[model samples]
Target: MRTSRDAPTRRIRAAVVGTGAIAAGSHLPALAALAAEGGLEVVAAVDVDTGAVQRFCADGGVPHGYTDLGRMLAEQRPDLVCICTPPTLHREQTVAALRAGAWVWCEKPPVPSLADFDAVEAEEGQEDDGGPYASIVFQHRFGSGARHVRRLIADGALGRPLVAHCQTTWYRDAAYYAVPWRGRWDTEGGGPAMGHGIHQTDLLLDLLGPWSEVRAMAGRLVHDVQTEDVSTALVRFGGGALATVVNSVLSPDEVSRIRIDCERATVELTHLYGHGNDNWRITPAPGVPAGEAAAWRDFGPDVPSSHLAQLRELVASMRAGQRPRSSGADGRTSLELVTALYKSAFTDTTVRAGDIGPGDPFYTALHGGAPGWAPAPATYEEASA
Candidate 1:
């Protein structure tokens, strides 16, 4: 429902929760940039650790900081709230903010499980008009490369996408796993599949379609952690398209790539050093007509940082009385894919998407919390220290 004329003239008042690495590294900077551009104004910050929140405010010159989220919401009444907490805390905090009448932009892996997502969804429907509408942070979808690929597919330039392969091979050492929630089944969700490879998985889902079935295997091959460090899955899309995914935190070097083979051509992209698509390759089928080759055009620099672009969109949607591009329902789809993967891994069989829903036992177990899965206490002390 948002119109172009609704572009925010003054800063849209905003607040942020969780002052950890992600908040400092991405959300804060992105919001600050938007504030400079007259898109958003960060009014307050909240975190369980009072010292951390105070320090962050001091460094960023923020006006207010609070240890309690409810108090901050009551006092600030921000139009926007950024949930930068871990995957486990996303559902509860996001729902709280939504109930408090603040629009929410939560980081990726919006919920640890599908049941949690359902809880949030149910609450979303019950909230008043002034309450927040939630959106998950899947920034890669905002990238030019992703958009270009989507355009090609939508325009039938790539023909019918038949098979897709996604790979996210990265390294996470003991030092990385030293954090309390880095490699846990409970607090951090699964492992590399949920934590590291989720970005690429989201991109795959964005380009292709929703998954219908998944067969997967997972193991903790490298890290001294409870969750799997490496995982792979065979996914079947709704339109009979087949796909494969490889996610790992133990590769010698990091290589993030996706290849989609369509009926007419093959599209590929690689983001080696970071999340940016630095290299792209498109190849047409052999003996294809010249006109088809001409249709394949390379796009120019149009990539915006996902966090910044999504935040801009969120603000725009709020001003226009419209919903965000990635809503809670959209987030639930991705989480369902993840849940299918986990179920497939545990049972050593293919798991259908329909088999896991709000009332299913698997769904119940996921939200009920995984018992005997706590990381060593030293990890907490190290993270807090």
Candidate 2:
């Protein structure tokens, strides 16, 4: 377990890899916030494209930037590394950082397949001296409303969890796919399901539990992409809890919502882009005893809204010699569900989570196998209409 004395006081030295959308939007801003408070420092930023890294640093007020990861790792030796690279590159970069004695907080989806995750796990196992711990970035878990809901479930205030419904509807214009890795199966992994939906999916797995089985269908409904623009799945949790996931990048408007139905009551949350916890609704079943209903209503205080909250927690854990709230193993569970969905879509059958292990043939085939999907046409009218 980590202790408070272990926390770095003179600013935690940090490095960032990749200069893409996520790096620019989420990770950079959060790290900048920490730097402003003197809690963290951005020591080095790296990208395969030097110009991109330099431009990002110029705009973000960062001083050091590099194109080669090895050179940066050898020279800077940052205490923490933030990997904002592509999905396929996560495993390799994470292992590289960890082996170099840097704690890694990488973006998701962690890896394209379970096989790759096994390789990362193997690398982690070889480390005898415990210095830097590794974790995955599932920032949605830090959202105030999500954390409150998790606490309520833990306290048994919601009673037995029976069912959950999650909807992730976000728009991705044709120009969004114009980028080389935007919607490609081999490069970006999967489309909306793996990219956007993975956030909510990770939250679902975090709040509920590991899924036991999954049956899913995916298709290129709108975007000109090699993966699904829209997908749906029916999931069965370990304790027989049922859930449904609806993810789409083709929706006309964007909205993210989750509804959990418990034995005693139900809770619903609706948060639009840029509107975190400002909008939420909780409704209990009718005809319930007033006392229980009131207790449920007064169970807790409102949660705060901040993406940096989890990062703070991670730093605290490192100081206290404890594991972060969401460890690499926990992060892998959501990815496992994603892999299972892809496998189910390809086989046209239900897939059990345990059946898709590292040694499974389906799991191994996913590494080099081409996605059985094609991109939609440039114009929706030309393709669908």
Candidate 3:
């Protein structure tokens, strides 16, 4: 029997860890809006930098700030905890929150390695008994445009999936990596492929389902960071579709594009950062009806996919005692793809779906337990920038 506990009307008490750009720019604002509507309350914030946390709370109207995560968890007892810290810090913080009886919402590149992600996943409540669960911020999958096309594909309006291409080619100059954690393997994980490209590619995986194999290569083409600035991969999906993926921080004219060719039509979305209905287009294959193509592009009620969209869904799912989309299991798909890409690039071999597991070195580190390339020399201005 369903009870009142299944549909919470009481506002969700929330706390945020890490006061970085992503927290300030995306999470905080969305949370603030939700709080304004009486759906959530920003109870506390945690950051290693006390001053940053203080400023974040003051500016965002949060009630409390703490320098330590454990202290915040103990004192606030929040219903939802947002882990906005760097990838390296994600595992410990997420596990701590889940064990503390709070549902967690974490940023992308959820953890530095698959082992760490699994460790965090193990702490969550099992099955539907859900008092606590965690979700990764893969907002690209929540947009109405992507939602519309995904429906079309599922309904057989798009027919059999055939081939596809996805790209995350955006430039981040030396100044961008000047931050201490920007490019190191231990810190930011694996450069553009892990940090930047994972967003679009996660959406691709969401649309296409499980990938079967990947052949790839990565290199430090321009940036002085320890990780690669560019990477390219050829992927084979379980649904009998093929794809070419490219991740690069060296391109001047930035764009995020994904094009899928199906037996009935070709669907494409092109935009940088966030996307709207205008950014998506569809073309019917030869001899196919023109009306289907028009209906494909006619996504109703333009909801630009963003952090807020996903966050709203996460909160609602928690209220309903349900594990939200992009749960640990859902997120592992994209992270597994990242692991496979790194393994393939470094080993000079094609990597299969289950090739990387407990025994594999790539399971622990994206670099396969090998030492990474030394950071290139930076000019004084570049270093200071």
Candidate 4:
């Protein structure tokens, strides 16, 4: 059920925080397209870079540009706040937006850690009370291909998922890490696992449902940064499925892929950043009706996953005062998996779902001391020794 203070469908005012590449490249265009359709107005944008924010607003034709988020919220009182900032700033920015009575659509790696995620979650209004909730931008899940696959998996059309593989293998060099926040525990959160591969794995979990346990390994194989550049894990899903996951920033050939072998059929999606219907393939097991396999391949239309795809659904959820997909528990689930992956990697233990809590070192910090790299984590070898 959804509850809202206003009519079921009304024009909403929106503000964009962080006028960086993501804001200029992805979010602004989506907002503009939606604005033209009379869904919302892009009233303001916020960023610490004065010149950049001004140029962004001028180029995007947003009415107001402010460096201070508090100022923007006070001035615009937007119904929706689209946060395109770094992981570190997400918690504070989202909490502020929710307190100002706005729904949030934040960029991925939503907060630095689970504790930060929980802090932002605390400030959100109840869905039954016409909330101002914060939703992580997991745009990958919004694509038509994923939606179609999820429907098939849920309906048992694909039969029980027995085996799966999820991998996010990409390359990032020294220049990319030179940004200061790109490869650090305190700022960017983690390596490709939290930063790059999260989208693909989140989509994996979206299809496979709950994961029961994970045993993982991560190392700083190439990067000189505080976090690992590559990691691998074996996961057990609640329904008795086993999977392997790899997150790496050292691969020469780049790809984002997920393949699931179910009891009756096999499904695969291969794409780099975003995917369309053509990227997906389904093969029914032998003896299954050929017509059934054809029906499984029928994805209605091609909606490539994008910031726009998620923003559209988020806006509708805000207007209807409903708990949108990828918010609250749904949003937190992927973060938990990442955290568990890290915990399992660092501690050499098989971490289970619901294992990390207030007292758990991993609950508040991925590196297990505090949110940042404070006490300094022992090397995996040192821990083993």
All candidates: TM-score: 0.89, 0.88, 0.94, 0.95
lDDT of 1: 0.79
lDDT string, candidate 2, 1-385, tens digits: 2223355465678899999888889888888888888788898899999899999899888788999998998998887889999887887898898777777888877777777777776665222344466677777777567777778777877788899998899888999899888787667877777888887788888888778999988877767667778889999998678999988988877888778898767887776542255555557777778887765555245544445766888877665555566665776788788878877776688999778875564564342253455333359777676
> Which ranges of candidate 2 are over 4 A from the true structure?
1-10, 125-131, 287-306, 364-371, 374-385
Task: Name model 3 segments beyond 4 Å from true.
Answer: 1-7, 371-385
Q: Compare the candidates by TM-score and give the number of the best one.
A: 4
lDDT of all predictions:
0.79, 0.76, 0.88, 0.89
Q: Write the per-residue lDDT of candidate 4 for residues 12-41, one digit (tens) a residue.
A: 888999999999999999999999999778
Pairs that clash in candidate 3: none
- For candidate 1, lDDT tens digit of each residue in 245-331? 999988988898889999989988788533443566788998878776765756667664368867777777777666677786666
Name the better of 2 and 4 by TM-score. Answer: 4
Q: What lDDT score is found at residue 225 in candidate 4?
A: 88
For candidate 3, lDDT tens digit of each residue in 1-385? 2211455898898899999899999999989889999998999999999899999999999999999899888888888999999998999999899888888999988899888888888888866676588899999999799899889887888898999999999999889999999899788877888999999999999988899999999988787778889999999999999999999999999999999999988889999998988998988888876775677778999999998899889888888888789986787899999989989988889999988889898998888865454344579999899
Worst window of 10 by summed lDDT in candidate 4 = 368-377
Which candidate would rank higher by lDDT, 1 or 4? 4
Determine which window of 10 residues in candidate 2 has minimal summed lDDT.
367-376
Model 1: how far is 17 from its true place, Å? 0.4
TM-score of 1: 0.89
lDDT assessment of candidate 2: 0.76
